[model samples]
Target chain A: MTTMPSFDQWMKAVQAEMEDALLRHLPATQQIPVRLHEAMHYAVLDGGKRVRPLLVHAAGALFDADARELQRAAAAVEMIHAYSLVHDDMPCMDDDALRRGKPTVHVQYDEACALLVGDALQSQAFDVLSSGNLPPERQLAMVRLLAQASGSLGMCGGQAIDLDSVGLQLTLEELERMHQLKTGALLRVSVLLGALAGKALNDDETAALDAYAAATGLAFQVVDDVLDATADSATLGKTAGKDAADNKPTYVSILGLEQSRALAEQLCVDAHRALQPFGEKARRLRELADLIVQRKA
Target chain B: MTTMPSFDQWMKAVQAEMEDALLRHLPATQQIPVRLHEAMHYAVLDGGKRVRPLLVHAAGALFDADARELQRAAAAVEMIHAYSLVHDDMPCMDDDALRRGKPTVHVQYDEACALLVGDALQSQAFDVLSSGNLPPERQLAMVRLLAQASGSLGMCGGQAIDLDSVGLQLTLEELERMHQLKTGALLRVSVLLGALAGKALNDDETAALDAYAAATGLAFQVVDDVLDATADSATLGKTAGKDAADNKPTYVSILGLEQSRALAEQLCVDAHRALQPFGEKARRLRELADLIVQRKA
Candidate 1:
């Protein structure tokens, strides 16, 4: 077996690629409405691990994907993620004051600006997908997939559940269902879109990628819950224990910390195993799966 | 010269067609989230003049268009309008309590539910466009046009301006620019989409329809400003004179009531004249344009 890269090295590579991809896809900040553009750049360019785009790019790399094509898809997914964050941090939602070690969009700008910024970014994702140089059929597929993943049936639905679960004791199954929709849906879409951008995949390849994405998505969330419980504010670059403080339902809350950690590891293993069909060709995807459950923040 | 139908008769026809179209497009509220679905139904089904949808249908008819095709386009435009109202009514934006003689979506349901409902409706509009039996190329064009019209360059951009313009004096030109983006973009899109649905139009037909939509759209807003100045809540079916109360910059504020009224009439004339090529076939559209500027509320 080829030696695996350290998680830090992998993350550094991912972060650089993400920044380049985002810069390339986004319109120059000076061109859009000043405040709206600023909020878009601020929300997206703020420091985060760039996990979603990484998953997209890494999954595409497994298939020897076109670099520019994958970049657009990666950037679009990140835009959607940023938009969700802006909306989620609003007073009507999670009411977060901090994100990625900086003030949340609403806190930094007015709430109306934050809301409009999110709306603009969300529309921008579809704009990117629709405007991309892909063939019409492929473009339609990408638009439909991303829309489904981002819309009420996916992340938004998950958010609704999360909002409802606040101050309520949610079972492990319920929390899992919520996360599957909220987080897993987009992650899965990212991988699927990346694979689609590369070449059409047969049923087996599609199934395997879906399984890998599903496992890694859940593992990613499991690790996130663990980090929330254990990481310090500086380490997390945000409010570390906010979930527990808000009495939010989380993997740790439902499964206990030890069990949650075990589940994450198992999920990572399953995610890596799902890539067996791709063999050594999917090295980056396998590495990503491994890194997902191991990261501290 | 052919005698024109009475304004009341034209309005009855548009209203009947609008009700039918709305009923046809929306699924049963029983299937989705109870509160959200109910709120959506309440917002759209509640009696309003259905101005946007009527414009879409009338514009389609101006080309001897298919009734069924026009209905779909009409429903799509109205759905977008409804979704915007739902979001605009949330606490973070306009914070209005009343809309169309009923409580605003956020007031009727929780703010979270209102937000999600708006999102669902927005997604649903695209869903209708893409999923209909329309040809793939037509569907793609429709989606692209609607996205641009509803997106940053369109209604949302106008809304951002409106948010920024509050408590500020905007010049007549600036107010026109804002309204053009805010209301005029969607209105123009409605006409363009109708032409598109009727099979691609020649350049002259397209140009004529665009001119018609542009004038009618601005006239629609001017009448809205006039109504806000002179009408009561009972006549308007929502808060009236709120613009003056809030010191919001509007056509009436910038040009005074007499000039605004004259401008509305001139716009209606220009809109009707743009449809000269369509002759008697454009009668419905011509009447709709006059009704828009002449309506009491």
Candidate 2:
């Protein structure tokens, strides 16, 4: 009998798969208007933890889906994540100079190019997601899902709330709602979309996976808050303490370090509990919840 | 027999239909993030001439397509157009203050809000387009078409080239190339997507419509150049002569005003010629080509 791969080994393999898919899917830098392509490449490649794509793969594997199609969906989600990061780091938004230990797109290139890069990346993500081997009906469902996750009712709406909430106190419920729309929307969709790349799941299975994803998504952000409060820039690969510095409300700010840590652990338990229905098929997702809560950075 | 509506009447009716569709399709401003929704509504409503949507309606009408589906497709295209205008008018790009005789999005709202508005609008466009009554196959095709027309190979690529070409003289070929990607792409897609909303056309009919659209799309830009050069800000509903002021290349700047006028007329003739097969069914399209050239603004 084959033993399951180590967590590190699984991560490395999925990361390589995602990297290859991204390189294959992105526009060639040699194309005309090379600067735009270059900026797009800079924004996406050799960066980030590939968390969303990994979630996509882990969830996709539950249904014994085609790896090739999962790679496409994974690449698409990563592109959307990258585009959001690029835009959020723009001068008018977060004005973050460093991301993933490199200068942000708007800092490396001009703001206009950064804006265009985000726009082009978004269009390309939908294009890639809706094409490939998925049946037309399934593809359409995926397109609608991604679109909803990315749009006003989801990420963007959450961002607007975040921007508005700066310097203002938010109740726990309000903060939860905001995070649900902002980061949670995309993370949950990543798992759902990954599963979608495979065979159809029963309603119960879909709900269980969604609950697992939703808990893990919030847990990820809660840990991010913990890291921001405890870690330094070198460890985080981005400016640490920017949340408090910007007067942005965070779990650490509201709940203090120990409580936030406790909350994150509780979320991890919830995430793992939700995956009980999937049995050992959800081992990777369970592992991800642990990693998210326990990571130092 | 019922008498066909005059050009004025047809324009008014389609404009009204598009307006109602946009209102029906856009996210209501009373939602949680009211400001973002308001900004989106402001960016889209009470704005520029509904040329693209009109093209969609005119093209879709050829095969007696469902009016409801045509409206959804038209509204989707218009949302894209509106979002582009909002971003293009941002401080990093054209930095225009006025559009359709009012402050541009970034001027009306803050730059951050404008940025989010544009991003949300784009996502919402894809969401609305891919949903609704259209078949999944047709919707997927529409999604792909819009994505291609909007991405690096199309509008954004053209805008990047335009950004780079400032203060530099470009050959007529280069100029046409930029316009083809920038303005021409969305315009052509408006016709094609509108056609796709209806019954599938024979190859000959498809080719003819494409040819007609290509000519008219270029003609629209040429006429825009003429208007930018000669019309006042009040009449044009945007800053006049800004292209020249910004040192951006235009047909009037490169080909001379008289030659540009002749080119526009020639394109209009070509547009009419391509529609010979459609006979009376092509009347609105043919008239639109004439109006595009002759409109003072």
Candidate 3:
């Protein structure tokens, strides 16, 4: 048999697929409120690592899920991520001027358009996921899962905690809890939804996948904190050292750079261990875990 | 048989039920990001006419739909409405200080909190609808319908047109098209979703309901423009005449007050005519059309 494609090859292909799918799913910029649609396209296209969609594709591959359905789920999750970024970078939130190595949505567009883009993107995400090749029941589950993941109890809740924790010292437990809800929830859901787009996993298999997702999710945040501290803005594609500048609590702030790096590595190890049951089928997931903890930006 | 409740009594009951359902659906303030939850509660509760919910209940009553399912649908639509109002009143949008006769969300809370409240409330609305007593497929349909109604093609799109049209002259057709998507889309969905919570309607019945919703929806906006010109801020429970102040085009601006009032009456008549198929079952809806056209606030 031919050798398996490298992780980089896999990522390149999936990224292309995701970009195309997102373009197809987004309203044409020529539509009414052309500016809003243009802003939405600007916010989502030609930007950022498609990490969420990659995780979705990687997990779905094991089950040989329907490709079209997988694309819908992948697009939906990435849309959520994009909308969150758009809103988070608003003047009322992080107030960042740059993202994905370009002007942020609110900076390139106006604040009102940024706000509407976020809102419209979110509604479109749900709209895309609600109807696809999947069974109606499964689609409903996807909607419920995504709604919960993005809502107050998940990413939004985590954001609230993050905002409140600013300028305040947070314990390791508190920081992890906040990250778990904020980034971790959506990341985990990405994997689960990817898996869901295919054959239903047995309870044990789903549990293992959930464990892998949770560990890698946290690891992703830990590395993010480390990068925010260590990387330059050009390399990171976002404002560097923003956490420290804003007095926001981060892993590096609480544990220092060296210890935070160690923690990310440990979490990656935990993520890999959680995938032991899947063995070779989870090779991609394993590679992703390593990539998350070791990326330069 | 006991006489059916009067329109006033029916309104009182549905309003109370909707209030209770909204409270039940909102996140408890004890949760983390308590402030966001508090703001969400403040934005939704003890405010507004609950007109959307009333329409939902009235339409559901026609089909003898499940009360619990209808309650969820009603609450979801109202939550969407509330969130839109919150976002629209933000500094970047309308910059209004009063809504529903009290401080707007951005005024009561900070702009950031107001933003988050709108986002979270929207998520919660979908969450509430996704797992209600209805079948999974129906729930999926509700999710899809609401998503379409609220997304860029609908309310958000209309708002964008509104924002863009400021200081620009929009023809009567363009203004009508904008209102159809903005207010009309949600109003139509409110009735459609309520009817959907019960047995599905045949095409003719669905078409009739859609026409009723469309006409009544436009009539609602027409009356709103008239009231905005005639009523004071205190009486209107919002910053009245702000449409003129902002130089936004309206029915009053395009058709003149007399013509607009005439249009409202004509639409009300059309709404009543569309309900003949439902006969006495549509009495509440018939009363609602009259109430909507005649209400001062």
> Which regions of candidate 1 are displaced past 4 Å?
A1-14, B1-33, B62-72
* Candidate closer to the true structure by DockQ (higher is better), 1 or 2: 2
* Tens digit of per-residue lDDT, candidate 1, span A1-297: 987666568668778877877776665667535667767788888468787878777778777778778888888888888888888888888888888889998999988888777777776776676666666666667777887787666787787778878999988888888899899999999999888887777899989999999999999999999999999988888888999999998999889999999999999899988999888878878888887887877
Ranking by DockQ: 2, 3, 1
Two-way TM-score contest, 1 vs 2, winner: 2
RMSD (CA, angstroms), candidate 2: 1.2
lDDT of 3 at A5: 92
Candidate 3 chain A: worst-modelled 10 consecutive residues by lDDT: A131-140
Q: What TM-score does prediction 2 earn?
A: 0.98
lDDT for residue B118 in candidate 3, whole number 0-100: 87
Scanning candidate 2 chain A in windows of ten residues, the lowest lDDT window is: A129-138
TM-scores of chain A across candidates: 0.95, 0.98, 0.98
Q: Write the per-residue lDDT of candidate 2 for residues B191-230, one digit (tens) a residue.
A: 9888889876679988998899889999999999999998
Residue lDDT tens for model 3, B1-297: 998889999999999888899999888989877888888899999998999999998899788999999999999999999999999999999999988789998998898888888888888888888878677777888899999999999999988888889999999999999999889999999999989998777899899999999999999999999999999998998989999999999999888999999999999999999999999989999999999999999
Can you list the residue pairs that collide in candidate 3?
none
**Candidate 3's iRMSD:** 0.9
Specify the poorest-scoring 10-residue window by lDDT in model 1 chain B. B31-40
